[model samples]
Target: MSQIAKTKLTQTQLDAHWMAYTGNRQFKQDPRLIASAEGHYYTDIDGRRIFDGLSGLWTCGLGHSVPSINEAVAKQIKTLDYSPAFQFGHEKSFLLAEKITEFMPAPLNRIFFTGSGSESVDTALKIARAYWRKKGKGTKTKFIGRAKGYHGAGVSGFSVGGIPANRTLYGQGLESYHLPHTQVPGTEFSKGMPEKGKERAEELLNLINMHDASNIAAVIVEPMSGSGGVIVPPVGYLQRLRQICDEHDILLIFDEVITGFGRMGAKTGAEAFGVTPDIITLAKQVTNGAIPMGAVAFKQEIYDTFMETGGADYMLEVPHGYTYSAHPIACAAGLASLEAITQQNLIDRVKEMSPIWEACVHQLKAASPLVTDIRNYGFASGMSIAHIDGEPAKRPFQIAMRMWEKGYYVRYGADTIQLAPPFTTEKSEMDSLINALGDTLKEQH
Candidate 1:
């Protein structure tokens, strides 16, 4: 009943807290707990230094314990801890919303805030359907998501999301179809965007014909699939998708949760890939992982449609929002993080470091026969491992655990090992991280 201050966790205490996306039974038997993090490394409970390979789940490109973000959070909690979400407003929220628009592409100036990436996906879906209804085309309610696309875990997002394990047990979600994934055969180790899969984007035409574009609300995808193993869209792939959406009258949504905010070496994925969507969902790095926040940015037309058609100023334009939509503390964190990103020019930092990153990781192709494929774009990368016993995820799990013991932190998902080093990482740190990974793979059975 009292506060537990001990850094070490008892077996009973560990059992009380169930972890998400983890094998709980195995983890409690041999846990890897991080006690603190600074700069680009984490210190475990036993005080061993571990390199931060994945940038805190792809959320901390500026690295950990940033001074500006820390100070802003402390001052905000003292000044304005919380604020009412409805009808009322806070100055920080307005400021944060405006700052966010500066990074988004032009005409996508309207902003809506939420609490996490999942919520942002759901909010974008709702906005798409609402926009159709306001235009008197309520029949436009279907959605199209690509195979291997990862939106998030909410009902709307989960249903539209394409990962089988994430969707199988949940049953049906919103009426949605999936386009084929872009990992075209025979194009495994190509650098940047592979040129072979441009036709894959044309699969959207089949889905449009099968269900009629008149009934479709939108097509949503990650510009570069992060959780789906960093599968980069082929050259001209996104452009073709944008062109198709234009002709069909269907809205296009880019779930940039993983690729937004400097991960793609640009203001947003739309800028990196040069393919703008009608709606863009964002989160993770909005506050540099210091505070939880997400947002949806859309073209001004969507917002104007609701305002012009709504009955009166007293009526709600759109009857939806979370209680913590724009908490003052989160707004403060967001503003500080954006300011730090701008001042430090971290986006350019990613661009400068990406070439060295790509060359270092690609060397693993010859390190061992177990590595089957490597995909990368900007600072994000993933390497697929040869499946053992037809269990694709097993080898990656073993590889990651070995990486942990060797003092590096990387993400293992599906059958791949993913890496996204902090933008501040130097060339020497990059070499050490990649060399360690190569040695680990060669050591694996």
Candidate 2:
């Protein structure tokens, strides 16, 4: 394909590719066409490389076009490109699953694979429901998700997800409730965890008491909400949720699609924060987004319940799976990506480099024209915008559009500009992000 003409892609040629979760009309008119990418930059059609600030949506931690990952996929294609995951097993897939367990919290080691974060989320929801039914508690079918949470756009995710715009059109969401999201006003512009937000976590207990815990099977939340704006949990919030879930006999599911794979500066957010959950739904960084894949890590007891509850050898264990459950090519990419993360020591890099990242993010604090608030932890930060009264999102969208034209890619929405650069991003690259953001903000109003 590289041998083909590297001609200019006119608006007509680009129009056909349906965009996702974007203002399609606005984007198509002013498209920032990327022709190639390497390391922390994406080369545009004119050969101008734009800095990648979101790590291709919180994946690509080892950086773009990592040779090791590309070579592994290339080799796998010729060796064993495809395979059936049902009743048939492949070495790479099983090996990848086993490898995943090594990073999971102890006793929460069983794995179920899927093709994306939404599938992982849906998978978790189904497993939570199934696990309860297997234990003869069939009535515990409902779930709880926190407000502003994003689990992706799939059916089950859309069902349990709490984002209003993502759910309003769907009409019937799951039979669920939400613990109020913890973005306290007083904590605006707070550094890592908000000081005043732990009390808000008590909302879960109130909901549990009001709804009667028996009817609820699980409570799922992002350890640090990403797309809804990188709101890190308050110091004791997750621990409180865990305590409440334990007392109520409810399962806790951490939607770690953004928090998993070293995003929060640890192998997993549960480890980063010292609070464990029954399951963690993961994707994105799993294969560095090179190949789409997702997974659900669950405790051993949940797997045992399914096995012990099932009839005999002839009976199916759990009636859940995907056609591309353990795809050979994806499994290949996952193995390579996992190796790259460990070998490059990116998780430790996140831990060591976070302070510098924080100082850089705070520089925008003085440039209040571009920032109303800032929230960060590990390698991630989100900057809220000072919006006009009737148009809360206008400033953010305008600034992001400006930044896009200025050779940078950053996420802005929900009234803030979000950043989760690759774990390997350099101090210089970090400075560039802040500089570009500062320039964009100066131009916003």
Candidate 3:
């Protein structure tokens, strides 16, 4: 066990640290502290083993306490713990960039590292605007994102992100418009990519026409909406968006922060859906969630435009980057994690496990009246519950708390209970997870 895991903190100590995206008061009353994790299970403070039904917030695909990743991190700390990312170079950063491009779709070979998903989204947005400026289209600065899509929490991400609750506190973010979410009626309980909602992509055309295509710089979307309830893209939905972007000279950005790195049964959601975007924002599983890191992959033309317009060889072409961009520790973790992903053929494992995952999650629909919708793709699934007395997210919150008591860890957002187990999870573990969920639903009902 790591030294950090061995140190126990009392409730009072925990209270000093305010958690993110958590109900502070309620959590302080009943804090569920995780002690350690191994494989697909987490040991809580009480020493009870809990099934990691959400794969550490859909990030630790290779599971927790991975030896190789730990070793890489240790070696890096001993070797080069810190290095300046700006106006400097690192071997691991370069090598990791090349390794990442191997998984990205063709032409998206340019990599710019950031600190988190939020940074990646903002970076991609800035890159889009900068690229257009270099290409003599300075007025094309507007962005269009889908209503249910979630980019990240950065200022630009919150602006582009379609979750109203996330954006409500922050007054009108970047000058951005939203496409209607693709979760149309009659598509509830979709097993895979549903046939409906393809025409929803045409909303971009309407937005383009309303704003004039020349004023639009980019359209960002998650191939499969993750945080705003795992709303899978309807068949041909992304393709249609790609075509519209192409026709209108708008850059297409895919915020694959949650769906990249084999989450979609392919190297990326683009590969899974057979649609490529001009830019792809990635994070979460890039370093298997072991370190804080995010990256943006851009098309070659975008890089070429910057290079051609850049004043001199030593000039900072893109005057944007985080202080910790491509931190050596993160690069080391990413290298080790990515190597394991490729060597283990984890993407193929996701493909092999997807059907079982689908079957397991779909079974929850009949388990309770609260379950109103079930949407799934690849290894991820989201079960939306019926609203409770006008409290849309209450049922999920209650369900998640109950799930915790029942020795399972799942993510609850809005009105949905999401599941995205590790790629290393076995069918038996999946069965246990479904059974636990079934029992929870039965008790709740």
Candidate 4:
């Protein structure tokens, strides 16, 4: 049992710890705490089983307390518990890197490890700038992102992330511009990749024309936007972006934090969509959420440029990394998670499950008047509700709170309720999830 399970916290004690991205005052007044999790359910402090509808913030897609991951973490802790990441090497890090690269597309084989998705995004941005510098294009420092696209929360991620609320307070940390988001008016309630919004990719060209292609280092976007609602790209959108980037000599970066692993029914969104980026930022299910770990995968040319540009053999090619970069425990967990995913053909399983998920989620559009749109791809989905009065995000927040009371835990942001069930969840469980959501919507009306 964990320490949280053993000890109960008072309202005052909870107040001491400031939470992130939460309404702290309201939470303290009525806290909803989870003591433990197993399979597709979380056991609350009072021993109530709550269905995990959001995959624990779009992380644990393999479910909780996975035996393979638990065993790997336990065994790794018993052996080499910690290692200094800099100036020293560990077998597990190199082995895990190799394992990860095997699943990546050709030429995108080099991996730089980080502690979280934020770090991975920042690292990719740094690599893009550094690679341009090495190629004698030191002025290529600007980055282009799409509106409503979300990278992680690092400084660079924040700059490139196009969510207005996430950026207005922090100020742009990098010289970044945004392309129009692909969620057009006609594409609402799209089942998979919508047919509309393909022209939205041309917005990248407009930015390139406005900013000048030579000034841009890279363009970063989530293949399927996760946090800024589960905004899946249009059918030909990603391919067009790839073509534009190539024509302009601009590097492309895909923030695959949520879509990587089996979430998209493929090893990576690049593979699923048949469009490859120069760099791919990964985290989340990389370790099945068993440990904090992220990685930046680069093409061979990018890796070689850094290696060849350094002044001395002993000098660091890229002067960036976390102390926990490639932590042994994380590597072990990642290896175990990857093994389980591949050996069990979890990606194929997700493909089989996606159609059913699409059908179940789309049905909400007709059942709930509040549902403005429903978007789905692979095993992930988002149901966007009409704003309550003039206040956006209030209705979804209320719905989420009601869901918690009814023994379901989901995620909501900006009038959107997102759901990404674990790959291991059964068809009946999915039916129950949709039914509960439908019932909740009905109650609201």
Per-residue lDDT, model 4, residue 227, is 94
Model 1 C-alpha lDDT per residue in residues 87-139, reported as the tens digit of each score: 99989999999999999999899999999999999999999999999999999
Of the two candidates 1 and 2, the one with more favorable lDDT, higher being better, is: 1
lDDT tens per residue, model 4, 1-445: 5434344776568889899889988877677788899999999887889999988878898899999999999999999999999999899999999988987888899999999999999999998998999999998999998899888777888899988888899864888999999889989887899999999999888898899988999999999999988999899999999999999999999999999988999999999999999999999999989899999999999999988888799999889899999999999999998999999999999999899888888889877898999999999999888887888888899999999988998899887999999998888988888888999999887
- Which of candidates 2 and 3 reaches a greater lDDT? 3
Model 2, 66-169: lDDT tens digits are: 89999999999999988987888899988999889877899888999999999999999999998888888889999999899998898778777778879998
Compose the digit string of candidate 3's lDDT tens values, residues 1-445: 4323344656568679889989988877667778899988999877889999888988999999999999999999999999998888789999999999999999999999999999999999999999988989999999999897888888898898888889999897899999999999989998999989899998888898899999999999999998988999999999999998999899999999999999899999999999999999999999999999999999999999999889989998899999999999999999999999999999999998899889988998889887889999988999888887889888889889888888999999998899899998888888888888888888877
Full ranking by lDDT: 1, 3, 4, 2
lDDT of 3: 0.91
Ranking by TM-score: 1, 4, 3, 2
Deviation in Å, model 1, residue 108 alpha carbon: 0.7
Poorest 10 consecutive residues by lDDT, candidate 3 = 1-10
- Quote the lDDT for 119 in model 1: 97
Candidate 4, pairs of clashing residues: none
Give the TM-score of each candidate. 0.98, 0.96, 0.97, 0.97
Worst 10 residues of 2 by lDDT: 1-10
